[model samples]
Every structure is written in structure tokens, then in C-alpha cells.
Target: MAFYTDTIDFTARPAFSNAIRGFFTRIIAAQNRSIDVERMQDLSDAELAQMGLTRDGIVRHVYRDIYYV
Candidate 1:
């Protein structure tokens, strides 16, 4: 007579977990950039000028990494 046993994958799902973590990381980063843009918008023209930034350039400045503008 012969017998067989079933096997299970008890290892951690690093790939799936990493994907989820990456998704949340991107979301948090985007939110932080939005907050930065808002804070920059609240600054005076002179203050923005001191940082070499313009009111119309806030979004571009915050999203420079993702956008080419």
C-alpha cells in the first residue's frame, strides 16, 4: 500500500506584501506632496521668491519627480 500527504506554503508573501506597502507608500507620498503644495501656496510672493518658487509652479515643484514640467 502507498500513502500521500498534502503540502502547504507556509512562507511569508514578500512579493504581495511589498506590493501593498509600495501602494500605500505612493499614496502617502502623494498626500505629503499635496500638503507641501498647499503650504507653499499659503506663502507670500516675496517668501516664495526667496525660495526661488512661483505660485503657478507649486504643483510642478512638488511633482517634479513624476512629471517633466
Candidate 2:
């Protein structure tokens, strides 16, 4: 399944808009973190070998997902 990482508010209320925006932001961040961790973990020994990645390399690559825009 696919999910949106953002929301829109047509209410034109500052507090309400801010709250909703913050909520979606947190959700997207969490989802992205989870995806990165899961993908890194799913790599097999041969796959990691092909990518020249060790356990530490996977951790480092996954951590870099936080900077994704």
C-alpha cells in the first residue's frame, strides 16, 4: 500500500493548520525511519556482499535516510 506524507487544511485556522501539519510531519518522519531500518535489515548476506556493505555500512546508510527531503 501507498501513503501520503502530507496533509492540507482548508479551514484557514492558524492553530488547526499548524497542528495538522505537525502531526503529518511527525508521521512522515517516523515512516521514513521505519522504512530505512526495515530495508537495511532485509538485505541478505549475498546482497550485502554485492553492495560491499557490512553491518556497520547498513547502519550508516539507513541513518542517512533521516536527511532525505
Candidate 3:
């Protein structure tokens, strides 16, 4: 008679899942920023000034947290 046993490890699963989730989160954030930039561009200079933002600074403003520029 003989007995055999095996074990499977799933330690990597959570790390992989987190990576995928982070990737999609960033994608969605980027899309939302793009929409914000477009909407901001449609506003007149006076309207943008009221918001304390400039057309040239739109992308930088939207991505300020991610980019230093």
C-alpha cells in the first residue's frame, strides 16, 4: 500500500489580482481626466479663470497628483 499527498500554493493570486485591479483603476482615472480636460477646454477663459485654472494648465491640473508638471 502507498499514500500520496500534494499541496497547491495560491500566495501569488492576491498579488496578481491587486495588480490587475490597480491597472484598471488607473485606466478609469485616466479616462475621467480626459473627459474633465475636454469639458474644461469648452469653457471660456473667464469661466476657467473663475475656477482658478487655465487652458494650458488643464492636463497638468488633472494629473497633478501623478505628474509634477
Candidate 4:
């Protein structure tokens, strides 16, 4: 008796979708971060001090939602 085996491969379809999704995700994340930074920067130094934030920490604070988990 003899047994036969076959292998299947997929290319392009999944990778293309993932690449597109990644591109869009990066764009959206950057947009969100930009908006956050702009709003924070618009604040007076006194206001930012009241909030206990600094210009240097803006990126980390903007993306804190992603990092805390």
C-alpha cells in the first residue's frame, strides 16, 4: 500500500491585507498622537504644570493608553 501527501501554500493575499491594515493603523495612530500633542502644546506652561506634564513626555503620555496594558 502507498500513501500520498499534498502541501498547500498561500501567498500575497494575507500578506497584502496585513500590510494594508498596518499602513492604515500607523496613519491613524499618528493622527491621534498628533492631535494629542497639539492640544497639549496649546496649553499654557502654567496649565501643563498644573496637569503635571512636560513637553518631553508628550509622546509617551499620548500613547499611554496602548502601553499601560
The candidate maximizing TM-score is 3
- Shift in Å, residue 33, candidate 2: 3.0
Q: What's model 3's lDDT at 30?
A: 89
Residues 1-69 of candidate 1: C-alpha lDDT, one tens digit per residue: 998779767566888899999999999999999999999999999999998988999899889989998
What is the alpha-carbon lDDT of model 1 when measured against the actual structure? 0.91
What is the lDDT for 49 in model 1?
96
**Candidate 1 backbone overlaps, count:** 0
Candidate 2 pairs with clashing backbones: none
Report the alpha-carbon TM-score of model 3 versus the true structure.
0.84
Q: Each model's TM-score, in the order given?
A: 0.75, 0.46, 0.84, 0.62
Pairs of colliding residues, candidate 4: none
**Across residues 1-69, which tens digit of lDDT does each residue of candidate 2 receive?**
998867886677988889999999989987887787678778887888888877667766665645542
Q: What would the per-residue lDDT of candidate 4 be over residues 14-66, giving only the tens digit for each residue?
A: 99999999999999988978998899989888888888887777667888877
In model 2, which regions exceed 4 Å deviation?
A: 1-16, 19-23, 65-69
Which portions of model 1 miss their true places by more than 4 Å? Answer: 1-5, 9-12
